[model samples]
Target: MLLAAAVCPHPPLLVPALTGAQDGPPTGPAAEAATAAADLRATCLAAVRDLLATAGPDADVVVVGTGPTPGSAAPDAVGSLSGYGADVTLGLARVTDVPPTGLPSLPLSITIGLWLLREAGYDGPARARVVTQHATPAECADLGARLAAFPALTVLLVMGDGSARRDEKAPGALDERALPFDTAAAEALADADTAALAALDPDLAHDLLATGRAPWQILAGAVEADGRPWKSELRSSDAPYGVGYLVAVWTPA
Candidate 1:
């Protein structure tokens, strides 16, 4: 099951290249990208591993997601973390086709969600997942119900552009919200393109997921980095571009 969603393009692109169609060993840009993702993955893994290392071994940390340089998908295990073993499952796969920058993209931010899930010991795989650039209110509601199934302590981590929006609408369900945003300069670079994604603002990003009134409502409101009033709340061809957003965690009170 997907515990968190990430918006970064680096991981999705790099993972496939590192574990390419006949991989002996990952090398070149793909290898570099894989290493970078692994490093981040390790950071997230250690957060849980530290809690489990002394806590005990039933320490089930499942990082479920498509392929890349880990689990059964990779030619060989990339490298082991100090405290955890990752389980790469098939359901975590990304929609095939549309290579980003010549590299296959996997929802790499899923790793963070997996780490949080492992820390809480809610290890069941998801029956179905909604993977997209953004999810609608209906989608968030459906996901919330699916996540509520695990009676055990569970941490719902959301990664990506619309995380904050989703959680604000339903804070009682999600546990955490995270996004790996580009720094100020990086955001500035996006502005130059006039691209939808390029408008994101680094500073406006929320450090943690904000609570949502209704898990799905979070996906409804629109925002702009400049604090400019929304030109139109109603869906239209000309809404002001949104740059930067709030990611959040929702849990039952």
Candidate 2:
């Protein structure tokens, strides 16, 4: 059964420790972005707490995000940002201390999601699903439905970001369609609009380099699967670094 959910962005910088608070004070090239990210991080953390609160205690947690591979990670799967210049490593749950068996490590998106989970003081065991960026809308929807079918009460911590090409500084560079696309996404997330999410154009998303497409669709599918009335608050919506980072908390109405 599905309980509630929190949606967030998966940028490595969300972990302040990564960039020494990600650009330090508001007086450098990334000044404005730094300030925005700090605010957004606060909102995201709060939203995460709200999700946990809505689910109550002893609820099953499922962490969902976009990644290069599409499937469940080993419960003991490891994640690291050492390659990203942060000398830290994290696990899906507790550190197994053993070598990885199949998957090398949890994908970057899932790894970051786990970091947010830890920051929110959620130290429970969690299942993770990494949807491929190229997955079709129907595929993500199927996965979402399956995720909500777990016997125990379940909560979702969905990780993703909207268009990354909002401006010239964006990774995908400027795209006229980025703003409207992200605006629509932000509105949908704020209102828990599943139909709008399911209708997101993958081709346009791919062109704008929006990695959140699959993960957001999964969220919509999960809500649809639950078929329960839910209300939501869009905690934050901003493209601090030309990447749309949204934070929202959804509770059963």
State every prediction's TM-score relative to the real structure.
0.29, 0.92
Q: Tell me which residue pairs clash in candidate 2.
A: none
lDDT of 2 by residue, 33-133 (tens): 66776787788888888888877778988889888777998888878887888866777774345533434378888888888877888877778999888
Every model's Cα RMSD, please? 16.2, 2.4
Query: How many pairs collide in each candidate, listed in order?
Result: 28, 0
Worst 10 residues of 1 by lDDT: 232-241
Structural RMSD, model 1? 16.2
Candidate 2 local Cα displacement, residue 190, angstroms: 1.4
> In candidate 2, which residue ranges exceed 4 Å CA deviation?
22-27, 95-104
**Candidate of highest lDDT:** 2
TM for candidate 1 is 0.29
RMSD to native, candidate 2: 2.4
Residue 159 shift from truth in candidate 1, angstroms: 4.6
Top-TM-score structure, candidate number: 2
